[model samples]
Target: MRVRGRLTWGRRARAGAALLACVVAPAVVLSPGVAVAGAAAAGAAVAGTPVCQVRDDRLREISGMVATDDGYVVINDGADDEALRRIFFLNQRCAVVRSVAYPSRPRDTEDLAIGRDGTVWVADIGDNDHSRPTIAIWRLAPGAAKPVLHRMTYPDGAHDAEALLLDADGRPLVITKGGSGTVFLYAPTTALRPGATTPMASVGQVTLPRTSTSNPFLFLGRGVVTGAASAPDGRRVVLRSYADAFEYDVPAGDVVTALTSGTARITPLPDEPQGESITYSRDGRSLLTVSESADQPPGTRPTILRYPVAAAADAAAHPTGSAGPVSAGPGAPTSVRPAAEEASGAGARPWALVAGAGTLLALLGLAGVLRSRHTARR
Candidate 1:
């Protein structure tokens, strides 16, 4: 789909005219690379701004995020035969409340999306090699016994589906991750049975733009689209790819129009960031992005990046405060924040005082010994 948020004509023309005038005037180059690239891609420049960034410490290949009454729920889709797929609960402070493992089939769980009625929808759409024509979604109540399996099979043929979203009425919206992304809105009340082809509508096609650098290091055309959700008003829908997340406003309940009509907006995120799951907070003002642990170092934990959507679209558009992940192993102490950045927080008060006292005592002791020696020599 043609996502929005590209600089409008007025903005473009003004910037273009300003740049043209700059040629006639003496232009001072700021950064070396900036000047060169600015002169090259200046005309076709798209607004690349990062609203927020959170270092995920608990995310192990996070595939989706859903904002719930408790907080944000994160998805971790592990490899095949591992049986390690889990949905983690994180409060506003970025603390992990709990983690529940879905009754996942080998290599089935790919992503997750939550329904309005608080049903946690776990999508088993990850097809690494695109060999399966069918995938499953486990829908369970917050604390319900193992999820009830909801299977989805594509009609035409097999597809590598990755993103899932449930509408306000609790309908399923399954989107396939492919060269030309396909959106399928499953009919409401349709039973998701094995080998069953639910009545679906073709919304449109979407393409995720890949970043230039692999700084955050993406999984390539593998298309790690980790986020999808229907807006709170049910008038809009959101999806995320590796590099950017998109918001679409589908008014007439027409999926086709929503896809083709120029009523979407694309927001650029961090560079080559893999985990792109997003969810709107209960207040509906703030949007949160959760990163995956697979994209980081082995022992590195996941992080939650918070951004005020309304404020980001208006403010300078940089990351706000972030919540890091808690370690998984024992004796790890669940250090949610980086050690260097944790010294000032309330939890670190005792340690910070002890470190300060130790430093002071060491300096005082050294000075006293030196003074004693100096007096003896005198």
Candidate 2:
């Protein structure tokens, strides 16, 4: 079904919300097969080898990624002058097995999500300049020729959104790109209406650490919310930035509250060129990522990389309180910390020692005073 909506001014970005903003691999002209499955790299920010390169001409600029029973569904950044409406389905090794074209012409298609009901959802949710009056989400059932389009409007105004998440109840949730190191959450009042303009309510906000986050003036770092995916079972939520990724344990009712309340488990996804989309594997364990293809060779072809689920789970287990680098074994992800939880433990010992010394001195002074009083009485 075809649908359209007009833009209305909702909320404009605050005064200082824009920010400034990949390499490539050699092209192997072949069908999608032979993706490298090497062990995940060690160390922080390691530009690990890619799982595979998408060589499909039409699928080269792979902007969104989602996992299916047999393969993956992907799309490109709708940044070109012409509008794009086609989505590609790729096999296990990243080959195009099929393509689904729907009536909706998204102004900028940045990411996609799969609902619990087996429907494939495409997020026409990218507004780079914050100029769009409305954003759209199109739902297509498996094997359905046509898609039902859903329009989402921000209560405040148009926002530059890239990440999309469907919570446990199958409700569409959004995290706007962070303009001031804090990303805003938005969602519809209920399960949205098809082909109707629905109002999205703001839920919560998250602020990244100082050592974390970037200036919005740079183009790449604009929102820090490039792609998002939820676990098939709805137990976990994964949010991605252009540079890294974070996983949060979803609370019973609202996942947004879990994210903004400092209950995040983060891991780095280093060295993907213009990474735009993220998804969970069919088994719902590992994470799959998609990046826009770059012209440069020897590195940075539109890449698909997998991060082990255990790595993320291990990080979440070890909340960072102690100071020092979080090192990983040969295959596990290197570090997990909320500003070094273990480091805080280390600092505590020294303070305890100082406190003990102060107590001892106080006791000694009190004894001296008592002795002097006895001598004065004599």
Alpha-carbon error at 171 in model 1, in Å? 1.9
Best by lDDT: 2
Model 1 residue runs over 4 Å out of place are 1-58, 80-83, 104-106, 180-189, 193-203, 207-225, 252-256, 294-299, 310-378
Q: TM per model?
A: 0.59, 0.68
Total clashes in model 1, counting residue pairs 3 or more apart in sequence or in different chains: 14
Q: Tens digits of per-residue lDDT for model 1 on 214-287?
A: 12322221134556766665665666665445556565565434544423344444443345467766666655
lDDT of each: 0.49, 0.59
The residue ranges of model 2 lying beyond 4 angstroms of the native Cα positions read: 1-43, 79-84, 209-223, 298-300, 310-378
Q: Model 2, range 5-83, lDDT digits (tens) per residue?
A: 3111110111111210001011111111111111112233444346777877666556678888888888776633233
